[model samples]
Target: MIKSPTAHEISYGLVELNPDGTIQRANDEAKRVLISEDGDSNYLFHRITNNEIKTKLHECFMGRANEFIVTIDNQPVFFLFHRSNNEQSQDRIHVYLFNIYNLLTLHDHNNWNNHLLSSIGEMAAGIAHEVRNPLTAVKGFLQLMEQTYKEEYSHIAQSELDRAIHILNDLMSVSKPEFVQEEKAAFNVCSKIESILLLFQNQLYDINVIKSFQDETAMVVGRRDQIKKALFNLIKNAIEAMSDGGTLMIEQYEDGHDVHINISDSGVGIPKDKLRLLGTPFFTLKQDGKGMGLAQVFNAIQSNHGKIRVTSEEGIGTTFYLSFPKKSQYSTQFIGGNTMLQVVDSKTDLTDFLFKNLDFYTREWVQYLEKNKSYITSLLKENGEMEQYDRAGNPIMKLVAQNILEIKTELIMDVAKERGVKSAKTEFPMHLAWELFQSSRGIIWNAIKSFYQESQNTLSTEEFFTLERNVNDIIDLYIDSYTAYYVNYKEDLLKSHRETVDELSVPIIPIAERVCILPIVGNVDTYRAKKIREKTLVRVKELKANQLIIDISGVPFVDTAVVNHLFKIVKGIKLLGCSTILTGISAEIADTMIELGIEIDNELKTRSDLQQALQDIQQFRIGKD
Candidate 1:
C-alpha cells in the first residue's frame, strides 16, 4: 500500500529512497528538480553517474563522506546518505536531496555585503581626504591663537576653537566604527530641535528654516542627545544636497497617542532603490560618505520605541519622518471665569490646534493667486491682440492662442505642497481649495475660448450683440468676485495704493529724442530697486540722453540701501557721459537722510522738488551753451 505525499513534503521535494539508491517513488517537485520531463526515471540515476558528481555520490554511498554536493542535469543538489541498520542484509542507506538554492542565495547575499563594504571603505577614504584641508586650517588657527592671543582673548578664541572642535567631531562621527550610544531622557523635542537650528544662524543665508510646532511645549520621553544628533544628520544631509540652496522644513505635531516629527529637504533627491536601503548600514551614494548617518538614525529610533520612514525621488527631494508614542498627561486645568479647575482631559485635535495657530497655506495661496493675476494682467497689457479678438480669421488670434497655451501649465505646485502637508489636518482643506481653483480656472478659460471662436465668424448685428454681452458677462463675473474677495480680505496686500488716484502719478516728461519720463510712484526695496536701475539704464541708452532728471517727489520712503543703489546708477550714467539730477526729496525723506547719517556724493545734483531738478538741468545745459 502507498500513501500520497503531503503538500509540505511535495513542495519541499522530499522523497524516500530504496536500499540500493535506485528511485523507488518521486514526488512531482522531486522529478522536476532531478530529471527533465523527457528523461526516463530508470535511466536518471544511471545518467547522473558519468560526471564528477558521480564520484562524490559514490563516496557518500560508501560512507566515505557523510554528505556530498553534486549536480544532476546542471541542477545543484545536496545529498546525505546514512544506514539505518549496521547488519549488511537489513542495512539500508537513506539518501536525502536538497536543491541547495537557499545556500546559493546566502552566498549571493554575502558577496553583495562584501561589495557594499568595499564601496563604503572607498567613500570613507575620500571623505577623509576632502575634510583634511578644513581640519588642518582649523587646527592651525587653534595653535596660532593659543600661542599669540590665548591669554588676552582666551574666551573668544576658545569659543572659535570649540566650533572648530564641533565640526571635527562631526567628521570623526562619520568615520568612527563605534555604534551609537543611546542616553534616554525626557525633553521638549520642539525646543531642542529649534535650538539646533538656531546654531546655524550664519549658514542660513540662502536657507530658510520653517518650524511648525503643533504644541509649543511638545515633549518626548526619549534619548534627547541621540534625537538631536539624528536631526542634525538629516539637516546636514539636506544642506549638502541643495548646492543651490533651498528651504529646510522641520515640522512637529501629535497624532492620537503618538508624536510625529518630519524633517524635509528641498534638494537633490535619492534614487528609489537607494532610498529603500537608506537606513541600512554602509549604504550611500554620496561621493565622500561613510553611510553611517542614517544607520545611526535607524538605531536611535528603534531604541526609543519609535519608527523612522524615508521617502525620496531622484530629482524632487527627500523627507524623513520620525514618530514616537505620546505620553499621558497627569493632570489638566481650565482657566475659565477667573478660576483654575481640574477637568477631564481630551486629547487635543491637531486640526483645531493648527487652525488656531498657523494658516500659512491660506496666506501662501492668496499670494500665489495675486501673483497669477498680476502675470495674466501683464500678459494682456504687453500683448494687445490677446485682449481683443476680431472677425475674418485675423493672424493676431494665433499669437493669442499661443499665449494661452503657454499659460495653461499643469498645476503641480499644490501637489508638492500637499505632499509636505499630508499629515496636517488644517492645511488639507486649503490644499483642496487651491487644487479646485486651478482646475476650475483652466476649464473656464478653455470654455470661454471655445465660445469666442464659435462666435468669431458671426458678424450679424444680433449675433455680434449676443457674443459681446456673453463675453462681458463672463469677464465681469470673474472680475467682480476677484475684486470683492481681494478688497475685503486683503485690502492692504500690495504696496501700490488703489484708492488715491492723485496720490499716484504716471507723468511722461521728454528727456531726449524719442525719450520720455517714468516717475517711480512708490516705495522700493532691493528687488524693486534693481528694476529701477534696469529701467533707467535701458531708457538712458535708448534716448542717448546727455542730461536726464529723475523725479522722486511721489516716493513715500527710501532706505540707505536704496540711496546707495541710486548713487550707483548715477555713476553708471556718468560713465555714459550723461548728467543725472535727482528731483524730489520731500521734507520727510530729507529728515530721514539726516537721521540716518546718509551722505550723497556731490557729483550728482539734488533738489527739493522735480521742478527745481528740471531747472538745474536746464541751467547746466544753458551754461554748456
Candidate 2:
C-alpha cells in the first residue's frame, strides 16, 4: 500500500507562531527539535523561548535578520524565521528548521581520508629513498668483492647492510614503540649527560663543550636507556653540524615544576622555512643522513613524558630545548638570584624562600663538610664522591623544607628510610650520615636569618620560635626513621645481596692501586649491558682508577649487539681519562666479530691474558712514575 506523507512526516520541519514566539501550529519534527534543546514543552505555550533565543525572535518580529542557528543534540540546526503579512491584519511568524549534520560529517571524513592517503604516499616514498641508498652501496661493494675476491670488499658490503638494518629498526621503533618495553627509574640528569658527552671524546677535539648544570641533582623518571639514546642523537647532531669547530653548549636548569635542558650549536643552521618539518620522518639537512634520527628523537622524548622545541637560523646556529617534569616536591621560584619582598609574605612564603635559595645552603654545607678533618670526609673529597653527596643530600634537604610547608609525616619518613637504605648499600658510615643532618640545622637557621634580613621582613618572636620548632620536629622525625632503617638494612645485607644476584653480575674488583678488573661472564642482554655500563663508570670513579681491565674470557658468545655495547663502554672509560684493556678474546669470538665486520677502535688496548695485561699496566705506571 502506498501512503501519502503528512506534514509531520515531511523532510523539513514547519511551524507557525505568534509574534511573541508562542507556538500556534507546529509539525512533529519542529516540536522534537524544540523539545530536545529546551528540554520541555513549556516554551510552546510560553510568551517567548529563553533569553538565549529571545533576541533572534525579536529580530524576526521587527523585520530584521531572519536566520539563526541553535545546537540540538550536539549538531547545529538552522532556523529561518520570517515575519508574514506585515501590511495586513494577519501578523504571524513562519519558521523552517533544517539539519545538515550528516552532510558536514561526510565532508569532513572525505577530506581526512584524502589527507591520510597523501601522507601515506609521502612516507612510502621517503622509506624507499632511504632504503635504496644503502642497498646501492651494498650492491657496489658486492660487485667489487666478486671481481677482486677481496675480504675488504665483503666487509664493506656487510657494513652497508648493517646500516640498512639500523634504518629499518629506527623506523619500527618510532612507529611502534611497544616493540621494546623498558623499566623506568630515577637517575641523576647531570651525571647521565656527563657520561654521554664522554662518548663523543674524539669529536670534541675541534669543538668546545660548555656545560652549565645549575641543578646537579635534577632527576627524572623514565626509561634511562631510551632517554640516553635521544640525548646522544641530539648531541651528535650538534657536533656534526659544527664541522668547522664551534661551541656546543649544553645547559640544564630547573624551574618551578619542570627541568629544562638546552643543547645549542654554533654551526650551519637550518633554513627558517623548513623549521616546521624538523622532526618529520625523512626530513633532513645532512647529505648522507638517513633522516630518521630526529624522528626517533622526537618520538623517544614524547613517549617519556617530555617536550622538545627547536629554533634555528641559516648562518648562526640551532638550539634544541627539552623540558621534563622534575621528580622533586619543592618549588624553585627564585630566578636570576633576585630576592623580592613577596618571598617573605607569610609562613608559606618563608618555606619557599628557603627552597629558592637552596643552592646557597648546599654550597655552605659542602664547604663545612669539606673542611672537616675526618677520614670519611677526606675520602669523599678525594674519590670525587663529594658531588654525589651533594646530589643525594639536596633532595632530603628539599624534602625537609617541603615538610615545613605542609605536614606529610608518613611521606617524609618513607623517603628518609629509603635514603638510609641507600647509604647502607653504598657502605656509607652511619655516624657521618647523622652528622650531615645535624649540621644542616645550624646552616638552615643562618640562612633563614639572612633571608629575613635581606628582604627586611620581620616576624614576631612567637612566629619565629614556632617556625624553629616545626623545622626541628621534622628533622628529628627524618633522623629517627633513617636510623631505624639503616640499622635494619645492615643486619639483612647478606640476604638482600643474595636476592639481587643479577645486580652483582658486573663486579668491579680493585686489582691494584689505580687499576680495576671487570670480569664479565654469561649472556649479555640489552638490560644487563646498560647496568654494566652504569656500574662500571661509577666504580671507576669511586676507586680513582686510571685503567680498567675488561676480561671477557668468561663470556661464551659475542653477538653484534654485545660488541657494540663493549665498544661504547670502552669509549666512555676513555672519556673519564681511564684506559681499557680488553682480554680473553677467544678464537670463536674473534671469528664472529670478523664475520660481522666489526672494527675495533685503534686506541683500545688488547692482551692475550689477564696476567699479561697486568704486567703491561705495571710497566706503564712504573715508567710514568
Candidate 3:
C-alpha cells in the first residue's frame, strides 16, 4: 500500500499550556520551524509564540471570539481553542497553517507590471512634449511662407514647405512611442556626423565651436537619421553645458563586437548625485532644461540594442559614452548575393596584399639593417650611449615612437576591419598602445623580481649594476629604434609627396622669396576651408607675397562649401595684392565641384597641372616687371 503523501506528513510542534501558562509539550513542526537543532525547545517555544495570540487563545477558550486568523511571515493560519464542562476540563486548542508564497509572488508580479506600464507612459508624455514645440514652429513657418508667397514666388515657397514637412516627419519619427523597425544599412559614420554638423553650422559659428576629426573613416549599420538625432542631442547638451565657452569632442571607435561614440565636454560636469539620473525621463540639472535630451538618447540607444554610460566629475567635465554593436560582413550585405560578392571580391588577401605593397620595401630595409647590424651594435656598446638615448628621447621622439606604435596597432584594427567592424578607428586610441606596453613592462618586472627572490646564487653588486644598465640600454635602444623608424617612414612619405609635387609644374609660380605653399590635406569641410583661407591670407600678407598657389592635389574630396571657401581665399589673396592660382583639379575633385554648382572656372584660374600654374605666374610677373 502507498504511504500517505509527505505533504500531509509534514508536522509542526504543537504547544499546549496550562491555564496558568506553564510549560507545554512542543510539536515536531513547531520545534523545526522555531529553533535550531541544538536550541532549547521550551525556551524557543515560549520566546517565539506570540503572547497576545496565547492570551487571545485563552480568551477564546473561555468563550470570547469563536476563532481567529493571523499571519506569520506572510503565511496565514487559524487558531481554535475549546473548553468542555466535564470534570477534567482539559483545554483543547488546534492551530491551522497555510502557505501564501504563490499569492505573494502573484502580487509582486502585478505590481512590477503596473510600474513598468507607468514608466512607459511617462516616457511617452516626455517625448510628446519634447517634439511638439519644434513641429509647431515648422508648421507655423510653412503656413506663413505659403501666405506670404502669392504667385511668383510659389516655387520658392514650395521648396521651403517641403523642408518644413521633412522636419516634421523627422520629429514624428523620433517622438513616436513605438520602437522603430531596424534598418541596417552600410553608411559612413563620419559623413553622417559631418552632415549633422552642417545642419548646425549657424549655431557652431555663433558659439565659436572648435572641432577636430581624426583622418579616418568609420562604417556602421544603423538608422542614419535616428543616430543623427541622438548625436545632435548629445552635442546640443554639451554646447549648452558650456554656454560661455567650452570644447566638445565627438569621437567614435570600435572595440571587439562593439562600436563606441563618445561625446565629451570641457564644461561644468554633472554633479555626482545627478549623474546616475542622466537618462531618466524628467531629470534635469539646468534651470531651463526640459531634461529630455538624454531621455531621447536613452530611447534611441535602447531601440538599437545598444548601451550608454556617463562619467562626470564636479569640476572637471562629463563624458557620455554610447556603444553600438559592430556590424559583421554578413549583416552588412544581407540584401542581395551580388552585394556580398562585391564585398568579398573587393577585399584584398591580407598576406598577399601586405607583402605586395609594403613587404618589398620592408624586407629591403630589414636586409640593409641586418648588413649594418655591427654599426648599430658598436653604437649600442659606446659608454653613456644609454644616457644619451634617454636624453634625446624627448616629446618629438615620443611622438614619433607613438606614431610607429600606431602603425603597429593596425594589427588589431585589421582584424576588426576584416570582420566589417563598425567604429574601429574610434575604438583604438594611441593611449591603448601605451597601456599595452606598460602592462608588458609590469609583467617583465614581476618575473624579474620573482626570479631574484628565488635564485640559488646571489648577484654581486657589480653584476646587479651591470644587469640594470643592460636592461636600461635595451629599453633605450628599442625606443630609439622605434622613434627613428617612425620618423624615417614619415619623412619618406613626405619626400615622395614632394617629389610628385615637384614633377607637376603648375602655372602659378611659388613666390620663393615671399610665398609659402600651404597645401591643404584631407577632406575639406566649410569650417576648415574658412580657417585655411584666413590663415593663408594672414601668412601671405606677413610674407609680402605677390603670388599664391592653393594646391588641391592633397585634398581627397570637395563639396560646395569647400569650393565657396576657395573662392573666399581667392578674394582674400587679391585683397592682399597677391594673385591666386588654384592647381591640382583631379577628375574626382572636378566632378564634385561641378556637382556643387560652383563656378570655379570664372572665379579663379585653374590648372590641370601645377607646372602650368608656375608658368602662368612667371609670365605674369615678367610682364609686370
Candidate 4:
C-alpha cells in the first residue's frame, strides 16, 4: 500500500553539471523528472517540486556552498557536491542522488500507523469519560422533571441539554482521527452551501451575508458531509468575526480547472505575521480560542485534495480562497481503498535556462525601466528616499538588475517570508518597492518569453502554463514580499512620526538674549507636566539664562500634579543660578495652587502676565547698566 508520497519516495533524476553550472548530460531518470509521468514528455526542469535542489547544486558548483539540504512540499532532500579529481578536468563536481527516507523499513511505516491509531484511541477514551458525567446529570434531571409533571421546566432543561450535546458533538467531530470524508457520494455544493447559510441566517442577524455565485451548482466528487463540515467551519468563523456587525461575503465561482469558494468577513483583520500561522493546531486569534474549528476545516479540505489561500488587511477584513480541483475521472490517486489527491505537477525548465543568462536578463530589466520611466518617476516623486537616490550610474536600475540576476525561485520565496516591516523600512517603502517590482517583472517576463520562444515549438499546453506560472511566481513572490513589507513600513513610519511629535510637543522658546519662555498651552496631563519640567531645566542650562519664565495662561486647569511640577521647576531653576518667574497665573490656577499647598520661593517672582515679566526684566537690566 502507498503511504506518504514524500519527495524521497518519488523517483530521482541525475543530471551532470560542468564547473560553469551548465548541464553536461542528463540520464533517463532526469528526463523522467523533467517530464510528466503520463506521456514521458519533457516537462519544465525549473518546475520540479524540489527545484531548490538544482539551485543548491548550482551553488555547490559555484563554490558558494559545499552542501545544501532543503525540505520541499514536506519532503527533506539533501545534496553533497564533491570535486572530481582529474588531470583533464579543471573544475568538475559529482552530485549523488540520495533518498532521505530510504532508511525507513516497511516495519517502520506499520509502526507509524499503529502509533497514530493508539493516540486516537487514547483521546477518544478521555472524551468518553468527560461526556459520561454530563450524560448522567441530564438523566437524573429528566427523572426529576418527570416526577414533578413540570412540562415547561422540562422543555427548558431539554433545550439547554440539546445545546450541550451540540457543543459536545462539535468537539468530538474535531477530535476524531479523521475529519470524516464521505467515501461514496457526488453532490452539488451549491445546495449544501445554501443550506448552511440558511442555518446561520438567524445567527448572522446583525451581519449582512452577501452571496455571489458565478457557478450555481458545483459538481463535487467526494463526501457531501465532509465538504459541508469544511464549509461549516469557515462560515462559523465568518459569523464569529462579525461581533461588531459587518458584512460576510460568500462567492462561489469556477475557473477552467477548479472551483473556488471565497468566504470573506469584514471584521478585525489579521496581521501578516499572524496570518502565516492560521491553520496550525491550537492556534487562533480569538480570546481563549481553540484551533479545533479550523483544524477540522483544513483536515477536511486536505482529505479531499483541496487548497486554501488567505489574504487579509489589518483593518479591512479577511477573505479565504478555497479551491477544489475540478473532480475528474482522469485525475485521481488511490492509496489502499482511499482516494488521494494528485496535483498536476506541471512545470517549466525554462527557468534554469533563464538563470544561466543573468546578464542578458539584467540588461532586459534596465531596458524595461527605461521604457517605463514615467511610472518609475511618479513612484519616486515626493518620497523622502528620493534624496537617497542620486544614482551611482543609476543605482536603482542596477539594483533591480542585481535582484533579477541573482534570484533563484527559492530566494524569491525566502525574501517574501522576511520582507515584513523591519526590512521594508530599512530597505524600501511599499509604493516604491512595488513600482520597482512591477516594472522589473514586465522586463523579467519579457526575458523569460524570449527564452520560451526558443523551445515553444515542442512544449505542451501544460508545459506552457508551467512556464507562465513559474514566471508568474517570480513576480508574485516579489509583489507578495513587496506588499507585506510595504504595509509594515507604512505602519512603522506612522508610529515613528507619532513618537517624534510626542517627544517634541513641549517646546522651550528663546525670545531674548539668555532668557526663554516655556509655554504650557494645552491640557497639562501628568505626562506633559513631566515633560515640561524636563525641557525647562535643560533649556535654562543650554541658554545660560538669567531668567526663566513659565507661561501657563493658555493652560485650562492647574491640577495638583501640575502645581507640584511648577514648584519643582522653580526649585530646579534656582539650582541652575537662574531666577524663575511665573506668568499667566489665572484666578482658577491660583486657587488650585493654594489648595495644593504650593508656595513660590522668596526669590521667585509671580507675574499676572508675560508682558509684566518682560517689563521687569528690561527694568532690572537697565538698573544694572
Cα shift from native, residue 528, model 1 (Å): 12
Per-residue CA lDDT of model 4 for 328-416, tens digit only, reads 43122211122222112112244355555655655555555656665555444444433343332222223333333223433443445
Q: Which of the predicted structures, 1 or 4, would earn the higher lDDT when compared with the native?
A: 4
lDDT scores in order? 0.55, 0.73, 0.54, 0.62
List per-candidate RMSD values in Å: 26.3, 20.0, 24.3, 24.6
**Strongest candidate by lDDT:** 2
Candidate 4 accuracy as TM-score: 0.31
lDDT of 1 at 437: 46
Which order, best to worst by lDDT?
2, 4, 1, 3
Clashes of each: 0, 0, 27, 5
- Clash-forming residue pairs, model 1: none
Question: Which scores higher on TM-score, 2 or 3?
Answer: 2
Residue 129 alpha-carbon offset, candidate 4, angstroms: 31
Per-residue alpha-carbon lDDT of candidate 2 for residues 1-625, written as tens digits (9 for 90 to 100): 1122343332457888776666778877776655334444534434334455566656566645557776656667677876664312449878887664533334444554444445556667888888898899999988887687888888888888998898888787676556446755445566557656655755789999999989765667566678888999999999999999999999999888788999999999999766766676777788877678898899889877789999999879999999876754212211112232332346576777878878878877778776773566775665556777566545556776786655565576678777888777778888787677777777877877887888787765534544564566567667766776787778677657644865778789998888899999887777677778887888888888888999999888877777777878888888888989999999987887788787677668889989899899889889999
TM per candidate comes to: 0.31, 0.35, 0.30, 0.31
Q: Order the numbered candidates by TM-score, best leading.
A: 2, 4, 1, 3
Candidate 3 per-residue lDDT, tens place, 574-618, comes to 887877677888887777677877675544778876788778767
- TM for candidate 1 is 0.31
lDDT of 1 by residue, 465-559 (tens): 32333233233233233333333233333333443432333333676443345577787777666667766776677667766677777778888
Candidate 4 deviant stretches above 4 angstroms = 1-348, 356-365, 375-410, 413-430, 457-470, 482-517, 520-609, 612-625
Best TM-score goes to which candidate?
A: 2
For candidate 1, the lDDT comes to 0.55
